[model samples]
Target chain A: MDRVPILKAGDVLLVSIQTDLEDRTVMALREDLAERIVRTGARGVVIDITAVEIVDSFIGQMLAGIAAMSQLLDARTVVVGMRPAVAITLVELGLSLGGVQTALDLETGLRLLGAGPLDGGPSEAQDRR
Target chain B: MTTQPGEQTHIVELLRSRRETALDRWTELAGAELRGRLSRGELRGELDDLLSLMLRALDGPDAEAAHDELTAALSEMSRRRARQAFTPTETAFGVFALKQVVYELVTESGSNRPRLTEELMAFSHTVDELGLLTFETYAATREQVISDQAEQLLELSTPVVKLWEGIVAVPLVGTLDSARTQVVMETLLQTLVDTGSLYAVIDITGVAAVDTEVAQHLMKTIKAARLMGAECVISGIRPQIAQTMVALGIEFGDIVSKASLADALEYLLARSGVRIVREEAG
Candidate 1:
């Protein structure tokens, strides 16, 4: 029953959560995501799941869905902090993350918010919730 | 029924001037038509032809004539795009329209055997979807170049259970280019807000190359995730990417990097204090 915490960092939005990805967790995330996305008026949003053991199909789809929705709301979204088990299982299942952007960390993902990485790197992090 | 010459002419003028709206409209509508045709078989013959042309272009020397033709078509389409306005769905349909046209032509020609008059029909059935997809036409194809990338991606990526909602894991397996990165960026953000997961993980172990663009994209995702109160975890740090980062003089602070998925899982398990029995070899 661990819930993910949503935060607004400087020029970026952060969503941090511990493992155990279930339906309630997902429902919590989806509530009013659009307004928060546009409120930033900045550029990017990062979803950090550094601590998660089991990321099933539902969670995967929901993440993808969130990323998709974020784009329309005027902000870029990145899915960071994936463990090996989740990566392997997602791949084996033939899941297509057709439209979601992904990165290794929050800092790197935020830099992605720039105009398509055309201006090189400004600088960047991993912190657990 | 709604083709407007005067309006289209104005759009043509706008496209020549590099108007974003007009260009987007033309691409969307045309692209949508291509999509429908490819999915429904209206442009089957054209699809086959285009695929073979792509193959020929790749295998042999450059097909300047074909290149010119494609460029002209794309340019013409852009002019059209500049003339019309489309919703997201319509724009998607337009992109699909263009996609189907090229796919139908390329695939059809690749499979058809000129020597087999007796089995013309049989050849038709066997070779339609058998050829390789190129990046020249579809930008997404370029991102899928790594031999096992997509195969690996499918397994590692979380399924779209909620379509536009949920925690999705994307294990980036290959090079990240501008075109592919754009798609990834948009999709991930939209997905995040829709599903609103606080945790979205991106594992990049199989990526063969990482440039400034890739690193920056990672940054962008992190930025966007934060706005929605989501946490982004990066698990894979291949030796090469690290090397590339150093070479590029990029600085990543406290970025999560695990040697493998098992290591990452252990980290996650530790967080939740959920212990499972590991098989002990006798």
Candidate 2:
């Protein structure tokens, strides 16, 4: 399935990470999706990784790379929905996504993407085709 | 406070045997340095005198060995130590004993002294790297090195050793470096050619990471297995690996990555009509 982790709102691709994102997979996803998000002219992008179980140095670097790439595409990026296990692993492995935006949940993630609160929630954004 | 006397005696006996070997090597090395030109003779007297003096020195201080030839061997060792920048410390005895070994080999008539010293030094280094300063330490290190060697052998061991024909399993674990990969492929290919195993399982469940290079190597291994009339099964792919494979777009044209070793075993057993007795769950 051609799944891009980023979603766009008025040119912003608000991405929701659905699986464990390591370096290779994340790079694959980013290369596949970054152009699409940029072309849409999204103001800011949000990445939701609540479902992820680990965030090693490789994944952290990918996020930072994606965030920088998104900004060059004229969109600020926010990473939201980080699981505690992922955070702990990231810290223990000495990793960080320096300068990447972060939020507690999709609501904040969506807000950081320059979209106001949805009438429903991320379920609504996910529900859209 | 309860100790098994059996275990203690076993250790003592092991040490005794090890000491005998070390002492042999030690004497042989030390004797090499004192070798002087012999004009076509057994030259047994010089060897006997040196061995007697060494044994006495080892047993306790013997007030002798004013022999000019023996002292020359000792000086040669000191020169080597000085060249290697080794100070004569307490540990120098170990070095001294070893140097004496090389010296003896070198001084022996009809012996290429330089080559013998090189061999002995390499052997000495191997012993040190094996983490045993003395032969007695070999009890544990030797066992460990043997297991490490066992692991190495598995990497080199052929998947196909035919009892009659048609049975093979290659269990892979740890890191798969190129050398190991080469060994594994050779073993598997040779086995497939020999036994003509109808079913071969290359179970990689024990492997933690399945990168693209490894995944490609697996493909090559599978292809080679097929050329020899063997069907290959790759077992033990966890969820993460499955996801990675999907992301990497690794097409399983023919090779099957099953769940576990047991699953692969069951699959093979079913094909071969070997019924497995299932133990009732607790």
- DockQ of model 1 vs. true complex: 0.02
For residues B39-149, what per-residue lDDT tens digits would candidate 1 score against the true structure?
Answer: 324233333444344333323245555544544443333333333332334323443443343334335445443533433332232222221111132333223345467
| Residue-wise C-alpha lDDT for candidate 1, range A87-107, written one tens digit per residue | 544544445455777654554
Off by over 4 Å in 1: A1-129, B1-167, B272-282
Residues A13-121, candidate 2, lDDT per residue (tens digit)? 6677776665667877888666776467567777777678656677777887888888787778777665534543554455545567665456645643546564534
Task: Name the top DockQ candidate.
Answer: 1
TM-score of chain B of each: 0.39, 0.44
Best by lDDT: 2
Which lDDT tens digits does candidate 2 get at residues B1-282?
Answer: 111222223222322344444456664443444334221122233334443443333232342433233344434434443343433342234334544444443444344434454445543453243222222232334456578887777645434433222557787877676667667776775555444345677877667888888886777666544423345788888789889988998777756767986787678666655566879999
Error of 1 at B178 (Å): 2.5
Per candidate, the number of residue pairs that clash is 133, 23
